[model samples]
Target: MLTITNVTWLDLLCLTGVGVYLVKQVLIKKNPAPYPPGPRGWPLIGNVLDMPRIKPWLTFAEWGQKYGDITHIEVLGRHIIVLNSTKTALKMMDSKSTFYSGRPVIPMVGELVGWKDSLPFLPYGDRFRQQRKNLHRVIGSRAAADVYNEIEEVETRRFLKRVLAKPDQLQEHIRHTAGAIILCISHGYEVKENNDPFIDLADRAVFNLSQATVLGAFMVDILPFMVKVPVWFHGAGFKRTARKWRETLEEMVSAPHKLVKDQMVAGTAPVSFTSTLLEGSHVSAEEDHAVKWSAFSLYAGGADATVSATYSFFLAMTLFPDVQKKAQAEIDAVVGPDRLPTFADRDSLPYTEALVKEVLRWNVVVPTGFAHCVTEDDIHDGYYIPKGTLIMPNIWFMLNDSRTYANPEQFNPERFLAKNGKEPETEPRTMCFGFGRRICPGVSNSHQLTNSLHLANAAIWISIAMSLAAFDISKVVENGVEITPEVEPLPGTISHPKPFKCSISPRSATVLELIEQDANHLVHDNTL
Candidate 1:
């Protein structure tokens, strides 16, 4: 046991460092006010052991019930403030955003993999404001975003044909369609129907991002010093992983941007977010980098969120046939069987809109949300929050809280409608996109304002409407018995509905003809 082989230097280094960290923390002055209530963390390691390895939002929700709305915890000498209620989150992150809009630079995901330039991990500063302003030019308002309706309609129609051909590959079709639309919008690039290089590259990068951001997934995140450790050292495998992931991420960010630039030089670049920003400007190296990264962020953010929501919509349709039937009935009355529903028809279909809202509310995507870093030392609600504290809003609990939503577990679109003289429940879009200055750009908003056009929400609505109009989705039958899919969301930065079985078929021959007609139209139309 005393031999060096039995106990490596890494273990010794970690233990010694923990002891030093604890001693240093103990020598510091006490808090100005007590931290908001939370689980009592152990010495040295703090709450590291108490933190859940999976679905931490569930644990955070339990903490919310036990210790008021705001819960505090410390891990590796870092303070975290978990806001479990919308009211508390709004007051802290919204009303006082000046002190709470910063994002903690994750060692593994950011510094190691060079993802810091992207919005999800970007710090709140002038750069952040600039990127938002850039997005404003493209998707800032509904009218501005409507400029791309043909693109959305074209790609979505292709999605229907893909689904019709390969019903078993529904998720793949959704992923492909999402990438295709975002690629067109971001760089005017067209993705291949199968095994596209750009799609493969971006998918691998995003998966790595989700894995890298998981709490305690890699030791480098906790002991940031580990990043500086030699790759040759034992137990330094994550460095190798970070290297490979960084390459993938670099390609994901640069490849499409390069394509746009090359096309621009050739005098044949289509109008897109990237092209529009670069066309008339003699851009400096620094400005060019900003444009490239901002375009990638727009693509990454809008695409991933749409995939999650659209996939969840299918899961919802399978799980609740009654809801699906009700939605289809409304669609039938409003849209009819002659053609599929389009964005122009969205306002006339209230029940379908409610159904889409319910899908969003019923399934919590981005469950815990990315952490919001505190920029200054401030006391919130009589509790002292240190300058570098990470403020995490448990968005799942807020959406599912029974106090706000009656029968919160039920999949009922009626909850969003005024029925029997009862008012509608609080809108989920207001809370789901997140809070404050760092609220997700281009995400859904309750009131139409001068912000990005809620691309992900818009994509989800169009896909759901068109799919419902074209197909009937239900549980699969095997061995003469219908199989119901189990409801579970896989844990990650972007939560996705677990794999499920469903049967999708054309609602009528007319719908199939409609899909064919759209495809024929796209074949002739080069603008899309």
Candidate 2:
């Protein structure tokens, strides 16, 4: 009996030891793999607590100082690797694009909105391939040139009219003008004058889309099984909002699509993208999903970016009037007072080109360029990134790096110009469009269109340069003390300046007559 009891006691003690070891392994240990260094964050919620609800860029930049070029954090089981430097970003995201080109499989967004098959945000695969090919056909460099003059004319005239009418709402005026150009080109619809239906529809769609990307939109993203549960027990609010977004988005897309379809049936539709896509002779019958996803891609890609660029133009103009003055002088010298600047005189206006490059680098619209996912286990700088990891190119950090740009915060267009005894190894274009095979295909065309808009704006700037030239652009005061102004951003993937007050007036009537004559010619047949 004593021997049997001893054996039983020994077995019990061994069992307890094993249990302790297992518990320690499961709960009290660090992650075995060597991940990139980042700040110590709480369990299950990583650097998310460090991020801001708005202007997360500032926080990310702060973190970059401590963590060096590449920082890694796990947010609720999601491995987010932020590329904080240009060399690392280009080396990994660009050089190894095939291994890191897929987008993070955003569960709620991918399943409901058909992002699983969309071009810009789709995972790297056959669906993405087909959609990208089709989009390239429509908005690629050569094709973009075809629509350049129309976009330039429409945006310029619309912006001028808005500035003339509602000088107080300059930011909104730029937004409306930019949104109108993208809508007109993407679909056959144009937003005219003030509060046009087309503008309202596009604006609503942009807002809804922003809601979908919000960090807390869908809790199901953090817990996958929630998707299997009933909607009432899950992200019920997200589901409802997503449906509303889908409806509003469909309204914007369907209007133009319906027109194209009706015109095609009656044989009168113009040669717009929607009309051409409807013909359906080019795409394979098996690839119907590609067609639908591509339509959404058009709206997503076109609207937010142009608006952000235009907003940057205004901010740059206000902060650095000397740059504006130089650009305007160049425009006047090339085009003369007899006529407004045209695309034909682009090369002659190098200062204007430099200004555009500076604008792109100064305030990047998409600070963290679209996140790309690692499709396969990759080795970078001796670090092993597991397959399915989320890789972010924190591009704003790169653009603002002092190593690349002198006095990075200041708006200096002359940095782009090749001055005497100075050589820039990397061109200004390197940071603007994007990196790698996914570089914005519409860049060349957008560059030209932006230049034309800038020239016309230069003329406008010259016309009114002296009038509002000395006008103070400082924040408004309440009760005699200068109030600390809040920086407002439009709620979307693209961040633009929020509305504020600035004074505007013509320097002289002589300059105003030139603007009036230019507006008349623009309003005529040559405009669109």
Tell me, by TM-score, which candidate is best.
Answer: 1
Candidate 1 local lDDT, residue 432:
80
Over 299-404, each residue of candidate 1 has an lDDT whose tens digit, in order, gives 7777878888899999999988898998899999988879888888988998988888888888887788889999999988899999999999999999999989
Off by over 4 Å in 2: 1-33, 43-52, 112-117, 142-147, 215-218, 228-231, 280-289, 424-429, 440-492, 506-511, 517-528
User: What is the per-residue lDDT of model 2 for residues 286-338, given as tens digits with 9 covering 90 to 100?
Assistant: 45446555655665665566666665666666656677677777766776655
lDDT of 2: 0.60
Per-candidate TM vs. native? 0.95, 0.80
Candidate 2: lDDT of 390?
A: 78
**lDDT (Cα, 0-100) at 407 in candidate 2:** 88
